[model samples]
Target: MNTTKAQILDGKALAKKIQSDLQQKIATLEPNIGRPPGLAVLMVGDNPASAVYVRNKEKACSRVGIASVGKHFSAQVTQEELTAEIHRLNENDRVDGILVQLPLPDGLDSVALLHEIDPQKDADGLHPVNLGHLVRSETGLRSCTPAGVMKLLAEYNIALSGKKAVVVGRSILVGKPITLMLLEANATVTIAHSRTQDLTAVCRQADILVAAVGKPEMITPDMVKPGAVVIDVGINRVTDSDGKSRLVGDVAYDAVAEVASYITPVPGGIGPMTVAMLLSNTVLSYQEKMTI
Candidate 1:
């Protein structure tokens, strides 16, 4: 029996290199622009996970010499109030990127707020204009998570052209955007969701399998094709049978790693890549401003 383990897709290492490059790029650009690139991350409520994510983003911005104008608000902040804040940031000359963290407090409309951000400054790349550009395959900012996934694949020189790609989620956050991106690369893509029939069979058909279903260890060995490359985008916290709390992806890592040719580990995989792409987006926006 051939038992060669899959080569690990080391996103953490790639993210570090990306940051280093971005930092050097910023160092050269700052003197010309008269100000460093600024990214404004507007965070509401106090969700612990969101808090940690926001903190990490600000720290990364600092390391790359980008200014962090992060705003914190209570869970009870009104929708009108949030919209006004977004508008203020839109007009701020120094701020090149604006992102409202996900999973906002109940009764708030995240979709409406996202629409208010200027497309050029939409760092999360969730705004309608940016997404439309993605559909048309035009030049524009793309969603951070999906952009990160594509970058990691490129870094590893994974061949997507004419390959069968399967994305196991339908959210705008990862699945839909990623499917479009894969198609752009000439990958015949299928989007499998919670309601899909014969999910395992669909997943097995993929040459490049992407899991972003937000379920812990949902993708198993049986669902993966032998010699396939797997990208795990879901990050879920769960207590194992031993009662230990840990972070795990949608793929059952250990078992599936044995079956696939390449796989990305949870925590170290999509997470940092997503942040790196966010910073990259900010820098791109800043550079575009110089030309305009």
Candidate 2:
């Protein structure tokens, strides 16, 4: 029995290293900029997951010497109020980056709120301007999760040129941006979504397969190509038969690990990298602001 496990991409470790690097850069820049780079994460409502995510992001910001200007609004906050707050952050010179936490209160329009943030301060990189820049292959703030995936691949020297890459999702947050990044790296890109027919056949042809669909363990071992590089961008909380809940990615880790040459584990994978890229984007904005 061949008991070889795939090499872990180790995103947590890389995220730490990236943070350390950013810390040093901030240290040097603070002397010139006169203030630390600032990031504002606005959260609406009291969703437990959003609370935890916001806390984590603020903690990461503090660790890397970036000042956190985060705020939590009431669930009853109006769309006009949120948009007004975003406009305020966009105008705040100290705030190098601005992000609105996802899944705002039911009546709130998340897209309109995101649109109000200045593209330069749009740290989440979901602004239409940034997305347009990505499509045109021009330099701009790229979405965090997909950018983190590309960074991990580059760190490990995984060759994307002329390779068959498949991304199994269609979310603006991950799927679309990642496909663009892969194409920029010279990969033949194909995106399969919920409506994709013969999803298994489509996935099996990938040399580089990325699962960003929110489904838990949707990509089984059979969907993976042998010796392929698998990147799991899904984060789903699942409870086992015993009733203990834990996070798991879209891919069935144990089964797929046996066949994949490389893979990213959930919890430690992509998650930390996403936070790291947010910090990077904030610093980039700070650097540009200082230069101007």
Candidate 3:
């Protein structure tokens, strides 16, 4: 008897489909709306990875006919100044969505600045008001990464209802929101983290396993249930032999792919979907504003 290997969840292809749909939607909306939806990106300092992410987001906006406005600030910008800029964007009629790139300089308070953005324009969906709406199961924009994960699962026709789902990590950005979204879909969800006892046993019970623990190669084959769906959300960079750096996911993909029924690959899986969802949210925000 031969065992079947897991199917790869191709996020890039799915994201392209979503982006194309959004482009068509924008075309229909332009005449009534007078112009394309606009997204304002506020990037602080010059973190290499953050720069890449912001650039990709802008490019996505351009592809979908959304106007992109970028405000790049120096590392030394003050918290008060950042808040003032957020207020300015919030008041701009042309700006439909606002995103402040994360990891501000050492002294800046990210959480405080998050609160300053008008919830209607919070493109990243990190504001307390939007998060509270999500907690209450009300309609509001969702965090891009978690929203993207749900979109990926739905695209593959994976039913979350009645499944035993486990999310490893409880970060506000990814883990907590995804767990809630799964629960909203009627999946029994468990959130585990670094301090979880008998973590392997807990993970092995999951029908759908999500690894967002931010550590490389943490979810091995031993921790997975055979035929479970594995979603790898951690993108860790490591130096291979000969000092070459490469991106690797939290799940040991090569080993876990042998046991799991389906898996998402690093770089190509969850990453692209995030930017796609952000564009979706921006368009949705713009449409919502028009109706109000």
Candidate 4:
């Protein structure tokens, strides 16, 4: 008997469908609510990657009929100024969601600014209060990347209940939150980091493995369990033989795909889903406001 290759989890197609569904919901809410859901994005400095991400988010908001307001501050902007801006957005009636792009300029405190945003308007779901809600298993906004990953899993009908899951990486933005989400779904979760010994052995035990270590090709075929579902969350740029740069994931897709039962491709996998979930968060924030 011969074995078949794993199925590919197409995030692009799912993201497209999600955007279309959001557009219809936004259209319905606009007339009755008297205004579209508005998202305020605060970007500091000019990191090229950050610029691309912010632009993509703006385009996603436009596609779903949500109004996006962007505020670009200089690298020299003071912490006081940044916190003040967040406070302003918190009080703005029209701003349904607020997102502060990560990796602020040197000397600026990202955590302090994140704490200043009203939890209700925290579109990125990184605020301590919102994260606390997730940790407590309460109903509230979740980090976009983790939410997107879970959405992808649910779409494929991957059963998480009572499964063994290994998440490589412990970052607040992706790893820790994802582990929590998996646990919420009844999966026994293990979070591995740079300090973990025998990481490969731990990963091989997972029924569902998530690679988010941010190192290109760090999770190879040897780390994967036969028939395990693999989700790649790392997006790193590397120079090709021609000296041109390209994006790749934490997992070695070619090698891992040969063994895994299912896999998400880089660029098209977690990337688009992140944007889709952000739009979903905006709509959810609006709905929450209406109920109050």
Off by over 4 Å in 1: 241-243
Instruction: Report lDDT (Cα) of residue 111, candidate 4.
Output: 89
lDDT of 1 by residue, 23-59 (tens): 9999999899999999999889999999999999999
Every model's TM-score: 0.98, 0.98, 0.98, 0.98
Output the TM-score of candidate 1. Answer: 0.98
Error of 1 at 292 (Å): 1.9
Compute the lDDT for candidate 1: 0.95
lDDT (Cα) of model 2? 0.95
Tell me which of candidates 2 and 4 scores higher on TM-score: 2
Off by over 4 Å in 3: none
How well does model 3 score by local distance difference test?
0.94
Candidate 2 residue-wise lDDT, 1-292, digit = tens: 1268899999999999999999999999999989999999999999999999999999999999999998899999999888888888888889999999998878888998888999999899999999999999999999999999999999999999999999999899999999999999999999999999999999999999999999999999989989999999999999989999999999999999999999999989999999999999999999996669
* Candidate RMSDs in order: 1.0, 1.0, 1.1, 1.2
For candidate 4, what is the lDDT? Answer: 0.92
Q: Write the per-residue lDDT of candidate 4 for residues 88-122, one digit (tens) a residue.
A: 99999899899999888899989888889888898
Q: Compared with the true structure, what per-residue lDDT tens digits does model 3 show for residues 1-292?
A: 1088899999999999999999999999988889899999999999998999899998899999999999999999999899999999999989989998887879999999999999999899989999999999999999999999999999999999999999999999999999999999999999999899999999999999999988999999999999999999999999999999999999999999999999999989999999998899899999986688
